[model samples]
Target: MTSTESSSRPYGAFPVRIGFQVQPQHAEYGQIRRAVAAAEEAGVDIVFNWDHFYPLSGEPEGLHFECWTMLGAWAEATERVEIGALVSCNSYRNPELLADMARTVDHISNGRLILGIGSGWFEKDYQEYGYEFGTAGGRLDILAEALPRIEQRLSKLNPQPTRNIPVLIGGGGEKKTLKLVAKHATIWHGFGDAETVAHKHAVLDQHCADVGRDPGEIERSVAVSDSPEKVGQGLLDVGTRLFTVSASGPDYDLGLLREWISWRDEQNK
Candidate 1:
């Protein structure tokens, strides 16, 4: 492993950040609104929702909402915490249009937007919604092509984004995904156990080296379980600074979010 992957890096230098993904499913819209408020109140750094038409779990017919529209509402409703999809599917809309939507949301939130996006999976969404469900590699190829267009569109917007509006790419495909991340992402959202994270980080670092970018230029984010005492420290040691715990409706239990917030406070101190 590179020194960049070593544990000797100052813990203080790697300040811990936490995010909450309030899965927009299995509850009324009001319940989701309340959950977002509660998560912000609990002191998360960012709030996220997934982009899909149907419920990812439980009843396929359960209550669900579209991703970008909810994001617009979230931009209006919240004041502090950054808002975005955990990942919007790159295949759903034209890249330029997605860029405009993100720019508008960035304005609405007064600069608190993280454009988390992915190549897309879940074939049912594509089929039911009249999209082409192609091979995974084909979808990734589409994402690779669209990312630059999105950036170009962002550059051309009339009322530019409040800030650059950080781009967060979510996926674990070591070849194309990590390469795109090395090239385009401000943040890379990944998942796995500590060993998995370490291996992927090394792969990502190699991708960065191949592209002549410092791997450290990109922040490492991971979706972690609620119990920080059990698994959080391992991930942190592997260079993951941003930890996200997901909460689903209807009750949207925030007990884990609270624990992570407390853990973040302790670690940062």
Candidate 2:
């Protein structure tokens, strides 16, 4: 690993940040709304929801809500923490329309929006929604094409975003996905343990160089489980700074969020 790509990816210097993904499945909208409030109160740096038409766990056809609309509500409901989908699948909405929605939510939240997007999976969502469930490679190609257009639309919006609304691209495909992250994303989110993330980081850095981007410019995020001690330390040591945990709704429990918040404070201190 090159020096820039190896151990120096804004990990130690960038203060650790915690996120809570309020999974919008199997719950009342009120329950999801309240959880966002509680997460912000508990000192999470960001609040997120996943983009799916139905429940990812528990009941397959469980009650669920739309992603962008819920984000608009969260923008109005929460005051401090940033809000967005854990990743809004690119295949679901037109790129330009998605950009405008993100811009609107950015204003609603006074610039607290992170446009987390990905080359969507979840065949059921595509199948039922009447979208062509093409090959993964084709989907990724579509995402690659959409990203630049999203940026263009964001620039041309009526009132413009409150800030240059941060773009977060979620995926770990070393070739295409990381390249997109280098080209557009302010944040890059991936799944895995410390070892897996470490390898991804190294690959991402190479992509950054290939694209002539500074490797440290993008924030590294990971979806996590258990305590900061069990899963966080290894990730942190390997250069991940933004750690996100998910809460399944109905009654959104924030106990783990509290623990992660405490750990974040300790690390930042």
Candidate 3:
């Protein structure tokens, strides 16, 4: 590998991996469970479900499942791929409690867990559940405070996490979010085209420098739903090694995921 190639490996020696987020909305629980099975059987590296009380898109009054409980079920059902919420809102559960939930799932999955978390959004979820729908900045502040407490609680939990339980922080905020990524995240989930991703990555690098962290220590990840041949290469050139493709339910299609998985294998070879 060239010097640039060596530095771009997100998890040191690990190769590029693909993830599928099965949106648990507008579908039966059985359909969602089958989707999880299909995703892992199709070779997806990580399988995620969003953390929300209701559907994010389509019908407002559609069926949706709670995030953590579904994850608990995934732990027992799937045998290979890691599982977690795509981005669990910090405001919904106490940070300490969330940490314990993650730990328990990690044990259940025999260490195949990634704690993907972010500041709360979606005002409807807050209003309906009676959670304070604070300003964006305020929620980010709470997340900033909560991250450490979660880590601290993880340390004190009985038996501890099975493998340090990698932290995947999702968001593209150039200020607080990226800074948090620099300080704590093992993986950073982001969105945008290649130019936008490169710019955000540059900003993330600056944060890492400011905090005296080696920028290469953080893995770059991006979400994509189409045209991996066009965008995936651009992202890889700029250091993104994890490509997460989102799939909604009713028919959580694995066609795109299979394409990305094939694409990942071709690139790694």
TM-scores for every candidate against the unseen true structure: 0.96, 0.96, 0.95
The number of clashing residue pairs in model 2 is 0
| lDDT for each residue of candidate 2 in 1-269, tens digit (9 for 90 to 100) | 34355355454466789999999999998888888888888899999999999898898999899999999988888889999998999999999999999999999999999999999999999989999989999999999999989999988999999898888999999888988999998899999998899999889888888889887788899998888879877888888889998989788889888999999999877
Please give the TM-score that candidate 3 achieves against the real structure: 0.95
Each model's number of backbone clashes? 0, 0, 0
Give me candidate 1's TM-score against the actual structure.
Answer: 0.96
All candidates' lDDT scores?
0.91, 0.89, 0.90
Note the residue pairs that clash in candidate 3.
none
Ranking by TM-score: 1, 2, 3
Q: Order the candidates by lDDT, highest first — what do you get?
A: 1, 3, 2
Candidate 1: which stretches are off by over 4 Å? Answer: 1-14
Pairs in steric clash, model 2: none
Candidate 2: lDDT over CA atoms? Answer: 0.89
Worst 10 residues of 3 by lDDT: 5-14
